[model samples]
Target: MPTLLVTASPHRDEALGNRLARQIAARKGGDLLVRDLAAEPLPPLTVDYARALTLRDPLPRSNATLELSERLIEELESTDRLIIATPMHNFGMPAALKLWVDYVLRIHRTFAPTPQGKVGLLAARPTLVIVSSGGFHRAGESKQPNFLTPHLEAVLSTLGIRAPEFVYLEGLVGRRATPEAMIAEAVAVLGDAWY
Candidate 1:
């Protein structure tokens, strides 16, 4: 099976999610492709790209905007399992990661609009979302609004990926939290899942 690692943490060594994603990918043992959004940010969604995907008539072959979107689509379609490593930023996804998501979830490439509603085109698979936050964002202890998991789940599910496995590393910001301990806990969780 083909596996794609989508990493978006600005933190290189310290980013817990990115490290966990790498560990998971290494253990899973399949064809691997890594897209590091922080290293190479994708172009934000533009009108030209949207026109290429949604136009009534086909656009010219030489349009660079369409080409960019097409490349992004190919990356998404070819993956069997997807691991998204992201740090929750200001209660949501980082700008680079959000842009990458926008690029992949194209109109015709990932979904089709029906009379009833939007339907997903891609095949369903196991999507692992590794999230690290400075504060707690889980059930009763959340100090922040978590748009990260919900937004990511909704977007990926819209493209036919369902029930993403969420692994969270939290409480790194407060006085009492140790990032190393949090990382150890997160790694233990990963060993239980997708190993």
Candidate 2:
């Protein structure tokens, strides 16, 4: 199976999310395509781009503004499975990852607007999200509200991805357990179901 691994971590070496994603990809054993958003960040959407998306006419393949969006959508369409590895920023997802989401969640391309709501056009696939946070965000132990998971779940659902499995590496800042230890434990749990 083809795997699309999208990583959004500023820290290259010490990022637990990225490490766990790579481990998951290795265990899955498939053609891996990595999109490191931190290394190659996407530009913010422009007004022209926004207008173009609302047009009834088809978007030209040569349009420079929509080129990246097109490519991102193509990657999502071609992948058998999708993995997003990101660090929570300000209790939410990183801006880079959010930009990626904006690019892929194109109207009339990935989804269709309906009277009821939005309907997804893309085929559903197994989606795994590896989130690394400095503090606890789980329901009972949370010191802060987690806007990342719910936002991602809603955004990805617009593209037909349902019930994405999330593996969180929480309490990485002040916790007694080492980050490495937390990552190892998370990986062990994932191993039981990821295969």
* lDDT to native, each model: 0.80, 0.87
- Candidate 1, residue 168: Cα displacement in angstroms equals 0.7
Native-to-model Cα distance after best TM-score fit, residue 10 in candidate 2, in Å = 0.5
Off by over 4 Å in 1: 174-180, 188-193
Which one is best on lDDT? 2
- lDDT for model 2, please: 0.87
Kindly list the per-residue Cα lDDT of model 1 for residues 120-183, writing each as its tens digit. Answer: 8988877899887878888899766899888998898888898888889887666255656766
**Candidate 2 regions off by >4 Å?**
56-62
Clashes of each: 0, 0
Cα lDDT of model 2 by residue, 126-168, tens digit: 8999998888899889889999999999998988899899989
Model 1 per-residue lDDT at 190: 64
Q: Which ten residues in a row have the lowest lDDT in candidate 2?
A: 56-65
